[model samples]
Target: MQSATSPLQTLLDLINETLSLILRTSLTVRSFAGRWQPLRTKLASLQTSVADISDSPHWAENPLLYTLLPNLLSTLQRLKALADQCNDTSFTGGKLHMQSDLDMAAASLTNQLRDLDLLLRSGVLHQSNAIVLSHPGPGSDKENLSFFIRDLFTRLQIGGVEFKKKALESLLQLLEDDDKAATLVAKEGNVAYLIHLLDFHNQPWVREQAASAVSLLAASNDESRKAVFEEGGLGPLLRLLESGTTTLKEKAAIAVEALTADPENAWAVSAYGGVSVLIESIRSGTPATQTHSVGAIRNVADVEEIKAALGEEGAVPVLLQLLLSGTITAQEKSANCLAILASTDEYFRALIIQERGLQRLMHLIQDLLSSETLEHVLRAIASLSASEPCARVLSSSTLFLIQLAEFIKQGNSILQQISVSLLSNLSISISDGNKRAISSCMGSLVKLMESPKPVGLQESASQALVSLLTVRSNRKELVRDEKSVMRLIQMLDPRNEAVSHKFPVMLISAILAGGSQGCRKRLAVAGAHPHLQKLAEMEVAGAKKALQRLSGNRLKTIFSLTWRE
Candidate 1:
């Protein structure tokens, strides 16, 4: 019996002999001279590839080389026979048939050249050498580990289904908590190969592992995320999300979320019809899958053009359901997606309301403990509050108002800002009754306005106060709190450049319009005149109105007489 080494040696000898025969026969061919030269060149190239393979010490161990060698030897033998036939001057074969044979032989040689080139470029021979020579374990040194990683990538390029599967599994293990390795893989341009395995023709387990590897690399850093998207990873990822097993869907969803985190990539997701597949994943996937799917939806919904597609693809209803029933992470993502959709367009806000999203969100707010989730829930409610009907429903919920007040009082700056905006929205167009009820948050709103930093929170608080102060009770609450009232007046000072003078000026105008003579005297005592005078000169909105209100008709006449001096 011939050994494995014997087969490789025998194949090399046969290739050499056939090359010699082709060269000798080409000189004598009478017909198809044009085809013979190209065929001869291709055969010579094939001979060189086989010779190179024979020189490698581990070539016998390379399964690809072994599997390819026999077929290569067979092609060489057939070409040798074809060369002899073409060499016959009086060939009985029809001219067309002989020409056809030459074309087929040339095509076969070209295919063999391509296959050999792939094997040489694939580094499979090097991988086989590593397998035979080194037994690097999990605790190998950095150099060996890097070599191992490169080997795995080479296997991904050229290995069969089983080898590819093992390589993918090993890659996932290496990527865990190893940003350096992941970066190396990405820099080496292996991410595209991983994405290619997501094709449905690959075995389910292979696709799953590939998806897993992609998710790990994607989560590594910004560069890896860009690599995945730039390599055209989203299309196959969406396909995997659609048809893979539950675990595979979860993996694919994770990759999708990471890739779409950059808003620029969101357009690609929409272009690939990923919005609908992601919506389905949210609708039917497990808790983890739902979490990732909604997270992706949130990221993609950042694009203004894609929001309508999200709603058109039925994202709202599933997101609402996920918000109600998914895990905490899933709920946070769902609420965030809904918030984005509702904030962008009135149609989505109305659709969410039509789907009973408001009650579900309020329900989430009541029992939720995650400040993150609460922030998103507040954002959605704030968006919904833009609609007067939605505002009325929210304002009527005493519990909801109290929650907003609590968040304003105790939540982080982000929550405080969002809660204040929601309060402002809810106060619009509502009755004095609802205003009075919502004004229970008066103290917290004043405190927020008093905060010196994060001018946004101060702006939101001042804006909310303007909306709330339309009620008699709210104005009285502001008027009676000397310090809070002074804070509003101080914010109007032209020297306080960080604060927008408009909202504070409007709040003070509302205050002086409703307060008594005592309040007007207190304003003059607080040095309101010079600030309003400077703001009026600067053409700040409502500055002249508040100045006029503060001076009153008698003070105006007295100031005019003094100016005439």
Candidate 2:
């Protein structure tokens, strides 16, 4: 038992002992003596000790410790630092001390000590019997805290609406940053109590606060989310989505978003008619509501049924419109939601393209939007690029290709990945115009193929290179580059099992297809033959073809030499 309480006990003893010393000392104005200097030093040490207590790992499990310890520690440190500064000018028995300095030290010390006295006397150390006290109870020990919780629960049920509202508000305020409180709330079955208030409370303010509290509790905690769902919280939240005041709607939407973060809860929400409610909110809710509603849809978009339902409920057009003219946050959310939906079904992808979604996305990218907003826009384009028709449309645009290549060169890793993926997909069918655009940016493509880039980016770049080499015009441009042979050889690492490995080998084969003896010699000197032999042993067709290309010239040279002899 002593071991369990050691950390808290040590902190309490330190604080109380320091406070007692300050109280017992003679803090006279301009009193610089041996005792005064040592006392200030001790106080400074205590301040440092208290700061360390707040960062301890054990406090995470004890909500009372986690929440109240930091507050107490901060106040103690502030008082100690202030007192140290005030005590800097001291009086000696035979030395002259400024009267103003003495007075100032006296005033500051007096005020700080009074504040310290109030802090200790606030009953923060007395956590037991919290239910009877008007002050918020301490949470250091959970074993005895249940008594207070049970009593609070009983009173919450028997109290009037106003009292219940205030009690719930107090509970939420107390539990805000403390996971111990959150666990106790769920363990003691108080989640249902909060939901009841949200469902039937007479005051709009009460319901809003209740929803907000539930949102916080359920945000990342699976147990609380499940409890909220099983206790029938979804229906009231859905109704709130449709008809509540904007603030209430916002809180309830957040709660709904939290609950639906889990797929089971998302299915339950849709079963209770949440899809239509969310769609309606997106169509007509305030900018805030629409923003959160789109976020909620993004969470559930991975489920096939939910994706289809959202698409059928006229969500695609509404979301595209939001992407066009809504607030920046709304635009980001709408783009992400559309990206996920388009990824699920080709029909949805086609609809987005038909609605001119691609044009809006291109505009967002070209306008140099925020990195966050651009991330979603680029993701949407990447998803839509999966469709061949969409690919052709994107490849047809010279400006889009330029912007995409620039993004790959200048954007962060995420942008590089999506842009590379989109370009690779577009490379599935390279037209003459597409070939020209890609060849124009061959330097960036070569940069992407280097060692330090992510494997996905490297693989995608290889795919684009493969498509470019297919065009005879593009091949002439690529063969002249000095890094071309070495880059192709780099992709044949034996550890890479992805079919993307075949691209570079096939590209080399194409380069050697109609080349002079010099080109084959360049590839063989780049050590392509050994890697090709290894790959051909594994029965890779491209490796086999590339090997044949490298040796075809050598065999002809030998036969011609024999014929001349």
Candidate 3:
């Protein structure tokens, strides 16, 4: 006969076995051939069962464990069966259709395991309900965590420095792993409490923790973020960034980043003299600090007034420095900010070019980085290329020209559009070398126009084509390609009368300007004449001219006839 175990010991044994099953099931399902939708449903159901058991009013009582253990065991049995089915080789069809669902299921199972482990290991379940309300460790019950936070919120104003610091630290921790808990903390008025702490707390660690907490809490909920700005969080945050220690400055920058996520917060940031403080942080703080500072600036730089303020405060020189020397993240942020600033103001664009930023950007593109980083680099370059001096520099660089063409063919859609726009600028006052490079890529441009890309891209691509057609040789090359005339005809959609009526219409006129009979016949056969005539009725000069050119070719052919009359 076997001896029966104590109730606590039996419950602990059940928890350990349940955790083992979860881990083993996760592994088996992960290695299965079929998609894990079946496994995901099983795990989610198991997690829900555990949550329901935990949420029961009698959950904290030891006697209830005996009652709940059978339900948990039943769930575990079903989960194991489902896991076995997932691993069954006899199942058919695609093997990885629901990878995302499988991933989410795994995470859910892991969280449940942690919660159960916490429930068993904490050893706090007594007949009496007088457990100590201390800071929560992993998998602490939500009720306990919320109670602990409520207690701390009461102490935040009147507590000693050490107590206040501890409260802020605990609050920051609770917010990190659980958004629901973060919401509770914010709803308890802890955000307002922390903002006050950031302003008046004498201890550096307290302010740092407070700033850190504010950042997370503000970002967690829309209401919390709005509350932070409404409660005057910007001034304290800016002051922290201005004079606090490096760690405090880093934390303050985080809060500022979150605050600026709302466009309305930008004004508060600038009004509180954050422009100067953020620039200083970027210049002097560590790399992480620089990244956050630049993020804050990027959020605000879109506002023209703030942009001029940053420029007035000499942000350009320091931003250029960061672009050259900072970490990869910092360089990315710096490039993004410079792109916006330069795009908004021509003076800033010229300044960036003179500071050798353009040359660095060219090199960055050639480094073959990710598309995201390359997009920012190209954006700044595109803006710079619009300036005559910068255009000359970019056009003169064979490397830059080649990279732009490569981007057009292989980059994402936005990158392709930007590349074509820059090419258009380069083609203006284009040197013969630049024209040759661009003309070599005429096929790529025509393909872009034919793609189902956005109308803006088609417009830009057509503009670049128009500029390239300025060269007589390029115009002849366009007519020689069969797809070019068809593509031009496709662009003459009455629905898109804006770009269709303008740039594509101009392109057809230029191709016909070469007066090739074959090109004219191709356009007519492609049914361009009707669309062109429609444009001519609308008083589009280019359309009228193209129709006239095509009509002249027809008249010439008739006059050359030797028919009997």
Candidate 4:
């Protein structure tokens, strides 16, 4: 009793005791011979007591030492039953089952891991408890040592494919927690292994859990992402999106999400028709499936053709339906899809309104106004409104300028983008009521010019302002609004190419709006800006002269600067 206890000693005791309990159960099952003999009574007693104690919430608070020994024993009993059912003879020393050896080993390994988890969670084992637990050390700590021991032992015992799959799944149950998983993946160099499981393992859960690990690994850094894809991660995930169980589909969705995060990843998903599968998953999968599918698709929507494919895939109808009938998560998917697709051409915009998409959007708003929807309805609404065509809908007899104005006043960034978009649509020139709505939106437009922006938002604002400038009347209004002009000038640095192009024209418009003197000065400055220097010369020289000049010294300078590195 006076003896001091060591960490390794305590861990060994836990492991040995757990193994002893497992041996006792296996021995009893074997000695009884009959699957349903007196031993069945003993088994029933054990399982009931174990479940009763484990299910108590307070059990997590005060973990009893060796408490997990019973669960491990029970789980081993379960493995024995599974083995017997399958005619698996694999047992102590791997002798009982020959043909079934791998399967039996896999099942027992899975159950054993389950037992370890219970012990660690109950705090009876003072180990670095996370199965996928990360960072075994502040470089030197007691818990870290435990994790190191557990992970080391688990990896050391890797067996056949089936056995490895079960063990990996149990490890994932440990690593799903981001902190632990991040650490575990780093140490194991598991990136390549996880990618392989997506293809080699046939069981849905095994691949599903493996996908989760892969996703985590890929999300860690460029090195892991490259390791996974280099090992053929992309193709298997696309295939799973086609036919796997919902759980596997979600897992695949997550992996796809991780792989496609970097712009480089967008091409990977794009290469083998990945976009088409993701779109279909969003349109037709279960609610949970759609949530993840939409997330993956959204990650890479920056590529335009991919967005158009998403639209033509009948994605809008299903997304709209989900918004109407599914959960809050479903509504979010629907809205996000709209936001992504809103960047597409006007045909879809006309389809959205012609198909009464506008009415459904308004109805969604009314329901939230009427009951329990997420306030992000306003965000989805703004995406729709961002299409100039959607502004036409806002000006519809059924909609209101005030609501659009309110969105400009208070909607989130996505909504603000669409609101500015709707204002830009004023150039379409509709009815008397529409004109008044457009004018009302003008004031709202001025308001958004002054608000804080989300990432890439100011670009959307800039394009809307530039689009508005083309409208003769709207130009005068925008020009008169000093706040709007200043904001556009500031947005010369927008992330979008189209918006960046708008800068020159909008800058000219702003100067002209400032008066004749302002316009003349802008013209001179435009003449001086590097881009303008050539344009001024070309304009004075005509098309051929401009072309020749650009192809001369300017071309050399451009090539030398870009090619030098």
Clashes of each: 0, 1, 0, 5
Ranking by lDDT: 1, 3, 2, 4
Q: Is candidate 1 or candidate 3 better by lDDT?
A: 1
Candidate number with greatest lDDT = 1
Q: How many residue-pair clashes does candidate 2 contain?
A: 1
User: Worst 10-residue stretch by lDDT in candidate 3?
Assistant: 123-132
Q: Which candidate is the best by TM-score?
A: 1
In model 3, which residue pairs have backbone atoms overlapping below 3 Å?
none
User: lDDT by residue for model 3 over 456-558, one digit each (tens)?
Assistant: 7776787788777777788777777777666677678666633546777778887777777877887777788888888889877677888888777667767
Residue 500 of model 1: what lDDT? Answer: 74
Pairs of residues clashing in candidate 1: none
lDDT of 1: 0.77
lDDT of 4 by residue, 1-565 (tens): 2111533235434444544454455554442245334334444444553444345433333222234444445555454554354343344443355335434544554554544444434342333243343434344454554454354334423333544555565555444544434544455444555666777776666677677777666666666666677777888888888887777787777767777776776866767788779878877787777777776776776677676676676666766776787667666756666655654555656666666777788766655442223334554555566566565666564355556556666666556665565544543444544444444355455445444455445444544444444445554554566655444444332332433333344444433443343334333333323443433444432323323432344466689999987
Return whichever of 2 and 4 wins on lDDT: 2
Candidate 2 overall Cα lDDT vs. reference?
A: 0.68
Q: Estimate each model's TM-score.
A: 0.77, 0.66, 0.66, 0.48
Clashing pairs in 4: 89-96, 89-97, 90-97, 134-180, 386-418
Residue-level lDDT tens digits of model 1 in 1-565: 2434477777777778878887888878877788888887887787788777766655667655565677777877887787788777767899898888878877877877876776666455655465532334656677666666666776666556766767777787778846577776777546877888788444777777788888887777888888888888889888889988888888888889998888777788878888889888888898888889889888878686678787678888888888878998998888888888888888898899999888888888889558888888888888888777787788788778777877877888889888887776666655677677666677678767766676567777877787788777778776777777677677878888666778778777877777467667777777788889899999999899888888895486799999999
In terms of TM-score, how similar is model 4 to the real structure?
A: 0.48
lDDT of 2 by residue, 240-325 (tens): 88888888788777778788888776777567778889989988888878888888887888777787788779888889888877
Q: How close is candidate 3 to the true structure, as a TM-score?
A: 0.66
